[model samples]
Target: MWKFSIRRILIMIPQIILLSILIFMMAKMMPGDALSGLIDPNIDPATIEERREALGLNDPWHIQYADWVGGAITGDLGQSFRFKMDVTDIVGQRIVNTFWLSLATLIFTYLIAIPLGITSGRYNDSWLDQSITGYTYLGFATPLFIFALVMLWIFGFHFGWFPTSGSVSPGLEPGTVDYVISKIYHLILPALSLALITTVNTVQYLRSEIIDTKQKDFIITARSKGASESRVYNSHILRNSLLPIAAFFGFEITGLIGGTIFVEQIFGYPGMGQLFLESIMIRDYTVVTAVVLLFGIASILGALLSDIILSLVDPRIRIK
Candidate 1:
């Protein structure tokens, strides 16, 4: 297992490098540089050119890429043109916010999805199963941002049950219990929005897996062994059915980052998703590239995590 893990890590090194190069080139291809947003439109062309030179924006793309790569290796991600701060510091603050939201989303998704899936599969074609199927269909059909907006309107605006925007209520002491509660309170709507949509995939996958696994010869053999219905289903059927869901767990981790872009923007939540959209709007090249690269790395790591999970869940499946 350790050897497999080390090999995967080594393999990821080149993937990350290639992903970074693609991200950097794509950022460079944007219509304007960071200076475009910073410099005055009325400034003389010569002054604009000098500013570019000073900021090293006028250098050859390869040279600029080299400088960026060197700085990135040493933990310097360059400065944010929009925020006038180090990109690392700016991203660091927002990523913490995103992490909490993502964790909440993951918990909510599994808690709600797994039980529904199990029930639906066990009672296939019954009223309860039909109802769950209908709900999953609705969730899958609706766009995430639209669901977020609807949730924000109903729970946040109409009912006033939750706050509409931001990570916390203004003016609260940061370390107080109230502040922590407020943070979680503000998170509910957006996290639920993401989770509702995310749950569709898991429920459907798990339900299908359960249905298929139940018809297998092993399930019949378990029943013939005089096992109780509960034991047969729980130990044989449900355990085998979970393999696919376990494999999907890694992509769900990446989705916690990539999927939140629209939901965060709709809720005005302070997270990497919102920061990413804001940076792109203003052409903050450093932040944009950094965020994209982070997403890429998350995707790679998520794949590794998925493989590890599969190996752990099914002891017969060796990494080698």
Candidate 2:
């Protein structure tokens, strides 16, 4: 296991290096430099040159990129060209906000989706199955922004149970219970928006796998041995059915890391996705590169975890 982990990490090093090169080039290829944001149309040339030099804009591209990449290795993400603060600080705050939001979404989606899918698949052709299928279809079919808007209208405007947008209430003191509650209050809408969309699609994937697993020859054999349907399902089918869902779980983690951009934007949450959008709009290359690296690391690690999980849940996978 340790060997596999080390190997995976080593493999990802090149990918990240390549990713940096591409992101840096893409950013450079944009309309202008980071100074474009700060420059005035009537700004004097001398002052502008000073600003460019201050930003190392006049440095050779390779030298600048080398410094950036070198700093990243030392845990310094460089200064945000737009914000003029440590990129590490900005990313840290957004990461904390995103962590909770993503955590809530992952919990809600898996908790509801997995059991609902297994139960429905276990009772295929039943009303429960039909109902679940219909709901999943609706969720997967809807566009994320539209779904978020509708949910905001229903939950925020109509019901008034959950806050419509933002990550927390304004002016709440940090570390207080009130602060925590306010945070939760704001998290509900965006988390729910992401969860509702993911759960439906994930459930369908799990359900199909389960239904197929239950029809295998081993299942028929188990039934012939006078095992109860529940016994066969619990011991054999469920284990095999998990093979496919385990794969989906890998992508789920990636999606959780950065897929909810629309919902995050809609809610005005300061998660990575939201930060990523802000970066893209102004073509903030350094920030965008860092965000991509962050997401890339997370996804690769998640895939490694999912592989371990797959090995555990299915003996066939382990043997191979």
The top-ranked prediction according to TM-score is 1
Predicted candidate 2: what Cα RMSD to the true structure? 2.4
Q: What is the lDDT of residue 85 in candidate 1?
A: 86
By summed lDDT, which 10 consecutive residues of candidate 2 come out lowest? 311-320
Model 1 Cα lDDT, one tens digit per residue, 135-199: 99999889888888999999999999999899999999999999999999998889988999999
Model 1 Cα shift for residue 262 (angstroms): 0.8
- Model 2 accuracy (lDDT, Cα): 0.81
Q: Residue 101 of candidate 1: its Cα lDDT? A: 90
lDDT of 2 by residue, 33-58 (tens): 76776668488989999988987889
Cα error, residue 22 of model 1, in Å, equals 0.7
In candidate 1, position 196 carries an lDDT of 90
| Candidate 2 clashing pairs, residues 3+ apart or interchain | none
Q: Candidate 1, overall lDDT?
A: 0.88
Stretches > 4 Å off in candidate 2? 39-41, 315-320
